[model samples]
Target: MSKEDTSLRFRQFEADDAPVVYSFCLQLIFKQSCWQLRKKTMLNRGWMISAVTASVLLAIGLSWPVTLITSLLCTYLLIWISHTAYSYYLRHNRYQDLCSTAAFVARWCSGGQDRLFVATLEDGTVIASSGIVHQDIDTCELVRVATEESYQRKGVGRALMKYVLRQSTSFGYKTVVLKTSDVQTEAQRLYETSGFSLSKIYTVGRGIMTVYYYKLNLTDH
Candidate 1:
């Protein structure tokens, strides 16, 4: 094969690698976000144990004294770990800021016909305000809802809730589902007022946050 052809194949391989890396990064960000939100610290003692083993193996191949090389490599590994943790911190924080908004704006902008609805503010500032997420099973299921702190208590959340329910009704979905933290009393009240009935309690990570699932039936619409 020609060198140019080989190079082109290598570039394609690299492009595929980029998406895999992005997916891994996004997964880590999500895990870290949940950990952060729940105040759960991921104890990583095994990484240190594994790093020590790696350093010992590397030092054996080095001409330098084993202690010196092992120490240096171990230090380097620790530094890299710290750097990775800090990068994850920055990435999730930034992503939370960017995605914290009216998700319907995205749907509106994309003219998406899918069950999701998203919206943004007028000033190019993402309202991060209240937003709704829905899934159609036998009916429209309110999968999730989130709103930025600054935009809460003003009915943006209720509006999104109603919007999703209306969309579900139009789509011929019979039910909507959602789960909320028990600590969020106001949110629970809002959901009840919107015609949602409590279903069950769920315990997530750390078992500290109690989540209550609610369902709303769309018979009238």
Candidate 2:
């Protein structure tokens, strides 16, 4: 597909789109979950919390002017460090059964929020895929948002996501939510720029992994 073809034709999925969609889903999930990315993001987030506390305590003994400067510096450092750390650690590996969090949309799309969509070229080559699941009457879940490895950052992923958000709004879901890993920084940007807010952060395996939840309000859409 032309990289400049910002108008990639999108439509509902078909039985034949299954294998390719599954391959893209797994590849992105596994590749982004690489330990190298996790280790890089985890660098000293635990330490920054301690540093922030220490700075506040250390300020107790200083002159007023110095104390003010120190507190500001500490707070700035804390926010900066924490943001960097989190930006790296929000990756998710939630793919489970056909109906799991990262459920393969091809075979698992059952209707409601589970409806799936795919992006294709005019010649019928599939290049991207995404889906939404209804968490409840008021909330929808986004999942399996993936693009061919070679197609990353060419505007395909963002198109698929915006499409999903529109679908969520159309289906009566007021909010759309999804979990993503810490290292998926680019994906997070897409979500945030699309009006999704960070709703919560969950850690499992005693901090071995951190998962982030993001939500987009579709009410005003």
Candidate 3:
């Protein structure tokens, strides 16, 4: 362990940490949702149709100025559509529903068999958090793993993950599972390095969003 890792401490989630954790979860969801929507818009058939229409107009002997203007208008329309879709997603997505209130998030994190862990500095500032929730008798789901942006690239996230896994084992879970979206490449890498294997892939939002499910068998670890 590095000196920075040694300076970090891990503890269970407290009531005061609810607001911070909820904010962190919201930030991550918003960022991932925006990226996913933007990428989908760029790759969707709408852009291809726009290009084909512009080409056909030019081929039909329209003036260069007209073709250019039409293409620019198409581009603006697509941008507006993307923005509208993102707004609608933010309003109706399940993530927003689950994180709708700090009180709800607090109850979810600490209720029943769910457990949330946080990594803090000596001064009690939470830099990272990870949660384990009951999935079944022998399985647990990992959720809401997040790190402060300024404190990322350090060992904070990894340490928090380790703590969560330890707690999962202590709770007699045989497997640990987590779901992350396709846009979270860094998080995917972290989970892979930590011994989680990709077990399933599914799409939501009318197939515009891709979600990956990863699992770690604690018995093998």
Expressed as tens digits, the lDDT of each residue in 1-221 for candidate 2 is 34447558888877667778877875776555454444443463544654565567666766656655665566556555554454345332234433323444434655544788898877888989888766889887888788998888888877777777777787788888898867778888878887888999998655656789997778765
Candidate whose TM-score is highest? 3
Query: Which scores greater on lDDT, model 2 or model 3?
Result: 3
Tell me how many clashing residue pairs each candidate has: 11, 12, 0
What's the CA RMSD for each of the models?
16.2, 10.0, 3.5
Candidate 1: tens digits of C-alpha lDDT, residues 1-221: 12112111101012222233233324433443344432322233434544565567766775446655565556555545654665466555644322323322333234433433332344322222222344645644453254444555666556656656766676667877777665567768988998888989878544544779888778943
Model 3, residue 59: C-alpha shift (Å): 12
- In model 3, the worst 10-residue window by lDDT is 95-104
The TM-scores, one per candidate, come to 0.45, 0.67, 0.79
Against the true structure, candidate 1 has what lDDT?
A: 0.49
lDDT of 2 at 183: 71
